[model samples]
Target chain A: MPHDHHDHLSPSGHPYRPDQDGPLTYWQAMEIAIRELMVEKGIVTAAQVREQIDAMDARSPAQGAAFVARFWTDPAFRDLALRDGSNACAEMGFEVGPMRLIALENTSRLHNVVVCTLCSCYPRNLLGLPPDWYKSRAYRSRTVREPRKVLAEFGTILPEGVELRVHDSTADMRYIVVPRRPDGTDGWQPDRLAKLVTRDSMIGVAEALPATEAPA
Target chain B: MADFAPGARVRVKAMMPPGHVRTPGYLRGRVGEVERVLGPFPNPEQLAYRRKGDPLDLYRVRFPLGDLWDRDDADTLEAEIYAHWLEPA
Candidate 1:
């Protein structure tokens, strides 16, 4: 499924700043004003802001999928990821910042899903900023109350005997779901397998696609 | 420092102290097992407001999914909770 990448801008791309009386919300205007003031005051340079944005923009689900694929193929790495997710990512050349990263593995009997009930805290260093649905209040409130229904909406149907575990990220920590590898792709290499991993699957909403269904 | 280990029974305190708190309302008074010690970190409740304080032990508490909801869906609900909000059940 195509992900939503909505942005507030006209097709022509003529700049629309809050100061120019465009459609910017009050809070958005205030944020821009404060940011400009901070830049003016030398508290934070505009270059620093751009650098941070660039770093986040450079990240994608591909990085996270690579780790999950590695875990699926390498039992020793899976142990390391489950034991210290942040270190494991670092060992793989991914920096997860100061926040702790926890990798939850999905097995035949148990499945794990992640949500930030209080706020939209996520593992941005690995998966980039969370999708819009993940930050929705409905998702935040419903996932804990009725996780099965939520997963069903995402087109994920668990086996009758399997259990669903919802992980609410409350503090500085972030979680990534290590989805169970699909059958029939037993001898596939990690690169080929990574293509089957989706952002939703890593969030525990859907399962990885089978070899036949995976994209070329 | 964390006082509890995995498999330890812990209950979230039901009280709602006034101020910024990271504890979710639904989990309060709920019983769960310590899934793991998530290590110590700066108290976010204080850090959110720029108040200085010592780091506190954080833990991942796992509760049976069936116990938290009335639905028949079987699963576990695990959340990361600061050690201060938990007590031996």
Candidate 2:
């Protein structure tokens, strides 16, 4: 009676996601039939299919945090990361796969912004998933040529003195911004430093640590 | 060069299936003439392993910027090309 969203689970066991494609409502017999048919035809093995789905669910955000950690304590490594993004990702136990990725470092003087100018070429291997706003058409079109305007739209006001360079990441590669370390974290270990690299900071939508509060 | 040459229409395809398709929804079901064709290039979606196939032929098909947005409201009449994925349309 209270505008129930999960009405499908009321009578049946299956949880119904309100937002699903197609005209059909929840509990589509067609989906089950198609899967069963595929299984019967041996188009894909059950275990193989299960494992693939499991792999998607198994993804963790720690992969990105680990990447942030390595860049904090090591300057030489940071240099390499800015030079070759894929190598740095590998050093942090992540892979960009066959598609190449680029790493951008946002400093006090320079702001490196990333956008899938064409589409959403996110670094899901490391970042897990892209945030909703990253996928918006507003972000894709405006970020490339009018970066300052777009960043401002995201509530990030780049200082007039600071130069904003937008990186247009396509499908083949990704660009990650190595955020700067906070000021108070003197003599901090890499693990501790990594904690400061918030996802927003890495995206250049927000500045890195050294603000009034450390990143959550 | 003229904005578009004759007999040079191209059918562009979507690079990604879901989430944020690079192809704007407005461009879908629309056809335009091929303004210019670049060399064969690798498909970004396929390279990401999100989609599969070989490199595709990309074209810089011109659509008036105003046409993409709103004809009356768009600031400049400057022409912009959307990345044209090869197709029969």
Separate DockQ for every predicted complex: 0.80, 0.08
- Which clashing pairs does model 1 show? A164-B75
In terms of lDDT, the best-performing candidate is 1
- Which pairs clash in model 2? none
CAPRI grade of model 2: incorrect
Model 1: per-residue lDDT, tens digit, A92-190?
998768798999999999888999999898888778779989999999999999888899899888777888889999886888999989998989999
Q: How high is each candidate's TM-score?
A: 0.87, 0.60
Q: Model 1: residues >4 Å from true position, as ranges? A: A1-30, A42-48, B70-73
lDDT of 2 by residue, A42-133 (tens): 99778878998888767754566677677777788778886677888777667666655566666778777767756687777777678878
Candidate 1 residue lDDT tens string, B1-89: 57898999999999898889999998999999998887678888888788985689998898876767655545788888898999999
> Where does the lowest 10-residue lDDT sum fall in candidate 1 chain A?
A1-10
